[model samples]
Target: MILQVDELGKMHSGKQEQVLFAHVSATIEEPTRICMIGASGQGKSTLLRIIGFMDREDQGQVLLQGKDRSKWVPREWRKQASYVAQQPVMLAGTIEDNLRVVSTLHQSVFDEKLAKRLMERAGLTEMAWSKPASDLSGGEKQRLALVRSMLLRPAILLLDEVTSSLDMHSKQLIEMMLMDWHEEEETTLIWVTHDMDQARQCSSRLWFLAEGTILEDVSTVDFFEEPRTQPGRKFLGIQSVRERKWSGEGINYV
Candidate 1:
């Protein structure tokens, strides 16, 4: 398996303990594209954080490439498996300067040609590269963060609503770029998205999370056509309602 979460659990110690997830076990093997869908305040981001080593689980083990996560140095492990947060922060410099930071951190030669190609693919103009990163819009920052994360060519990428801020055109561009990259590499993708259409397009499997646990894990085909759990079915039903509303089909039922 590329990555494995074995009975992993996380909890917060507030006035009343909040268990984010408990006994959550999942395996990501090969270059499978897995889309995680859940309501807000669910543990989708929390689970991604644990897998990326950004947060520690209360119990259970995380294994990467058949070895315990503890065996690998934190930095090296993170380089191989990276996480892109929902709200990304940019450095206080030009776009090119921000992209160049990857080379400095990785001790690898910067690939300017590849950077230029990626920028074009991401719909970033040359002029945008010279502008101060702080001046960019939310969508621009989101794309810049994606570019930075992908530059490392991580083996496993954990994306938490990475395209949430972009317009439809930019969103499509980034999705195309990412799908092309996935097709050309042996990287595994675990994307958390509320956009069901995007999930259907990019993922081969769907994982439904609710109430501090994974309610469903199935192939994308089965997820939409044959959801076994009530939560999975309900989520799909909601998506259907939204689609209908968007298509001007009046909804008579709540």
Candidate 2:
């Protein structure tokens, strides 16, 4: 398996402690698109953070490439399982500096040809590498952030609402670019998205979080066609289909 989570449990730490979620288990045997969706406070971002090694899971063991997370070096783990935050922060320098940081930190040669191709695919060809990275628009920053993460050549990409703040056009661009990137690199994508359409369009599998855990894990088509759980149906705005009974006098709604 590429990745595996065994009984992951998390807690909300503060003045009063509470269980955020528990009994969450999953395995990614190969490279494919997986979308995590749920209402607010479902710990979607936290789950991604935990998987990326940015946050610790209160209870459970995570195995990346069949080795426990605790066994791997922090930077080495992060190199394979990289995260792109919702808010893309620019380094204090030009655009070139931002992209080069990844290679610099990894002590690897910067691939200029790859960077140029990624920038073009992200529709950032007009951008100047010499210009200050801070001056770019919000959408531009988000796209650049993705490119920076891609430069790491991670096996699994953990995206935490990376395209949530962009315009429809920009969001579509990001979605398209991500799909193409996945195909090009055969990267396993664990993307968190609230937009149902985007999830349906971009992901091959759906990881539906609800009631403090992953309530549903199935193919995108099967989940949308008929969710097995009430929360999943409600999230999809689908009423209980099987509950409808045919009455002798008239059709029963329930």
Candidate 3:
């Protein structure tokens, strides 16, 4: 296994203590695409944060490549399992500066040629690369952030709705870029997306999370065709209704 979570537990302690999740366990084998879907506040992002080592778990262990994540330095852990948030922050600089800064990290070297090619694939014009990154559009920033993550050459990529606010063109381009990046046999993807169609498009496995636990983990085909659990069925049913309504086939409520 590439990564393993052993009874991971996280809780909030404040004026309002909240138990985000308890006794949650999952395994991520190498070189596979897994999509995590759940309603908002169901701990999808929380789980990703824990996995990325951005947040601490109240309890449980995170193992990477058969060793505890604690055994690896934070920088080394991040270099192997990188994360890109929904709202990516762009530093005060040109696109070139932003791309070049990744070289200072412990991961992959800065490849100007590869960076330019990635920009081209992401539908960014040469002029845009010279413009200040802070002035770029939301979609453009997302594309650049994706490129930055890719430059790290992480073994596992953790994305949390990275393209949610993007236009269709930008969304499709990002999806394509991610797919191309995962063409290698050593890279794994753990994507957290609310878009079911996009989830199906990019992931081979679907992990259904509800009430702070993974209710089911199955192949994407099985998830849609034959959901095993009631929660999974209900989730699929709701999405099906939404899709139908979107197609202008509203239910005839007599």
Candidate 4:
């Protein structure tokens, strides 16, 4: 398995600890695309954070390449399973500085060519690399953050609504760019998104979170066709056959 999430659990710590979720398990046999879908407060982003090593789980473990997360250094694990937050916290300094920060910290040569290519793809070709990253708008910052993460070329890319801030055109560009990147690099993409079109565009498998656990883990076609649980069916409102057909393959990211 490339990555394994074995019976993971977390709690909201306070006067009374509340169980967020438990016995959550899944395994990635290879580099492929999977989308996690659910309503808000399902611990979707929390799970991604755990997998990326940004947060520790209260119970169970996350494994990458047969090694448990506890056995690996945090920095190294992050390099392999990079997380891109919905609201990105930009690095201090120029746009170029943000792009090259990962390589600098990792003591690896920065891929300037790839950075430039990604910036262009993100519709940031006109943006000055010398400009302060903090000066960028929210949408621009979101795209910049994504470009920075792509520079790491991690095996598993953890994305939490990375395109939520972008305009429709920019969103489409990113979707296309990421699909191309996934194809070229064979990277495993685990994205948490409410945009069903976005989820459908980039995934083969869909994991539905409900009732404090994974209610369904199945192929996109199967889940959309007939969700096993009532919550799953409720999550997906009534869509016609033609609309559901797009969920299968008709809607291309490109």
- TM-score of every candidate relative to the true structure: 0.90, 0.94, 0.89, 0.92
lDDT of 3 by residue, 1-254 (tens): 79999999888543267787788898886688899998888888888988888888888999988789759998888878888888888978998888987787654568888888788887785646678898888877887888887787888999989888788987898888888888953678899999989988999998889876888888998897867776787787744565556666776656
Roughly what TM-score does model 1 have, to 2 decimal places?
A: 0.90
| Of candidates 3 and 1, the better by TM-score | 1
TM-score of 3: 0.89
lDDT of 1 by residue, 1-254 (tens): 79888998888544268787888888887888899998987789989988888988899999988888769988778778889888888888999889998888878999888888888898886546788999888888888888888888889889999999999998999889888888987678899999989999999998889867887888988887757776676777744555567766877656
* Cα misplacement distance, residue 243 of candidate 1 (Å): 22
Candidate of highest lDDT? 2
Worst lDDT run of 10 residues, candidate 3, spans: 238-247
Q: Give the clashing pairs for model 4.
A: none
Better of 3 and 4 by TM-score: 4
Candidate 4's displacement at residue 10, Å, is: 0.5
Task: Report lDDT (Cα) of residue 76, candidate 4.
Answer: 94
Candidate 4, residues 60-144, lDDT tens digits: the string is: 9889998997689889999999999999999889999999899998889999999999999999999999999999999999999
114-173 per-residue lDDT for model 2 (tens digits): 999989878889999999999998888988999999999999999989897788877888
lDDT of all the models against the reference? 0.85, 0.91, 0.83, 0.90
